[model samples]
Target: MKKVGTMLGNIAMYFGVFYALLYLLRSTYNFEVTLSFAKFLSRNQAMFMAVLFTLITLVYLLIFRIKGWIWPHADNNLFRVAGFRRLSAPRVWLMVGMGLAGSLFSIGLIVIDDIAQLFPSVPALVDDLIKGDSAVYVIMGAGILGPTFEELLFRGLLFRELRKVMPVYVALVLQAAAYAYFQPSMALSVISIGSGIIYGSLYLRTRSLWAPILVQITAMSTIFLLKYAGFYAWYDKLNEGVLYFITAVCLMALIGGSIYVWRTSDQGHDWIRVAKARMADTPSAAPKGG
Candidate 1:
């Protein structure tokens, strides 16, 4: 039933975003201009949908910004997840380094995918999309706003909600798989799932959303900037020798970072315990006095 509710929430979120786009289309643009823009985007259907999706999702995020906070705390009057919680600057920076390490790991997956021809090329698709006037829209829409909203939904809501009824590990795995499966290609799926785990682990450790949000923005904005600047061509031209070395470096970083996260943090020890405590505790009850 909890899963069902989550499914509904996911559906409603997308629908809300879609409706906002429809409303904007009807109100913000005259029919003739709208027709012309549609025709223009029709030149690249993939980018048209991507831009439209991002804009709609951004509008949805703006509308429910307050409500989004409310849900995290809805578990108890004490939402330690993000709203009322924060990490120290030093701790946040530690996670930043770890998350970037993970980002390198994800990028390495793409590089390998390119070599193996394992999936459709996202860079090529973005190249098709990021032309002329749409560049700014794609950058802001897909690069920045899109990722923030995903974290809001996946990290902020779904993971916390799952923590209520299930074990922390269970919630993490399920959420990670869902995140990966929703992405465009198998290669990206692998990368997304890997990122989802890192993000989920960070949230659990710090009980703060900002850490993962920062990491996501860093990874996504870098990729978007690269695409915008036509840097993927240089990436494409890189010899297999360089690709192998970078992939090995990324793998080592990922392994080392995961070790650091596990051994150096109490979050791993607290993972299941925290969920159990929160799950057993109820909103109607008073928060325990420390």
Candidate 2:
């Protein structure tokens, strides 16, 4: 169908163009430019790439916006927090909380695997991306830049477009699949797809990119920091009893948070405000309002 082809083509183009631009910038900084630039890049590959890629992606997004590309506007309702805000606020805190909870949930899956070995080990590429990278680079890339671009494209633009034609759940699956496809390894791909489902659902309910962005940033940063701090190493050394207990606690938090959101989301916009709005919309409450 034309719809499927358009979606796939859009995915391919986004990645293709992004990588092409990144490669071009990197190649220029490495070879086409001065020797000092090349040395700097060679020395701080990951961090430098994150900064550059994030910068370029932002610029590309700007250009697309100016040109009226097939994308959602960042100034719209979904992007109220587009530019990181100056004031420390409650919504920001909420995003951090949701992000932390979501991260714990996803990593719980891996901890479960460590105990059971039911899943295959992470792919070599995924392992390299995870364990081999230095702290500064990993934190910048995975924590900040990665979350920014990914949320912008997937939940911000792509999902918006898909929802126009298909059901929200269907769009969530399609975008999740797209998200998974871009990951390094099969294991990560699977995990990302699962995570995408949760994130997409949250986005649908919350209508704010910040919620999922925070979740993503926290998830990635926590995983990287834990790996750096040897938490996983310590986890591996734990006996089955402790492992099971930790795993269960994480599962509970994950599932509990998910259920709370599902049951209490009140049609998905501004949780603090949703409750009053929900009550006001009920027939009895409507009569009271009159």
Candidate 3:
């Protein structure tokens, strides 16, 4: 019974958040109640929702700590796990490069508007919601709130927990799939899922939640800027010809190459050391040398 309960708890920990999100969306957008809980949420309570979700994630982390379900560190270096010093220059640069690459890919899709057409429902929904004094709500939701909450939950909590139960690759792919399902636009869905995988891999490699958080925030901010500058719409009008294809390909290749180099270089080794050290500090974690 204890084993069954643990299994159920694990499943609920991951999928329950997702279920809550779906319920929030459906109740607000799909049904037509006079009070329109969805409108109310978008207008007045979006920040509350974001904070609530963040708190839920923190609670899960606390529970896991109490249960001794934490990862082991590499060398028993307490210094590596607790402070900003663990964040190295290479890791930061790698995250920035990855973020830029993701931004370029998303921009290419937007340029053709091929991405927007994938989710014909979203623009109308967005337009309707932004009609009143709530225009800033869209910006806050997408740019700040969504990235902060979603990354903390998915990359910070879910991926870390999943690593304890599954192989790293399997954990990353599953997280990415969840990210895709949550996206409102299909094109954005693909980008989100792909970026989720990248972020997951970085987290696994670096063992620092901060790395992925920075990347996610940067990517989201770039998207918001493009949208605000009208570059997204203007790109749609340009010819989606050979030049555009070449440019996209080249940009993607550069980004991928940068990530590859970073992962393969000495900086990657330092991050691995830091991760192992952090894992060692948890109560249930084995000693670094052991």
lDDT of each: 0.61, 0.60, 0.56
Give the best candidate by lDDT: 1
Tens-place lDDT per residue, model 2, 188-216, is 78768877887776666655666677777
Q: Estimate each model's TM-score.
A: 0.70, 0.70, 0.66
Flag the better candidate by TM-score, 2 or 3: 2
**RMSD to true structure for each model, in Å:** 5.4, 7.8, 6.3
Model 1 residue runs over 4 Å out of place are 1-85, 98-116, 132-135, 229-238, 267-269, 284-290
Task: Tell me the TM-score of model 2.
Answer: 0.70
2 or 3, greater by lDDT: 2
lDDT tens per residue, model 1, 211-249? 677767666666667655765557656776787787678
Q: lDDT by residue for model 3 over 139-195, one digit each (tens)?
A: 565556667667666766555445444455676798888778777667557656767
What's the candidate order when arranged by decreasing TM-score? 1, 2, 3
Candidate 1 TM-score versus the reference? 0.70
Worst 10 residues of 1 by lDDT: 281-290
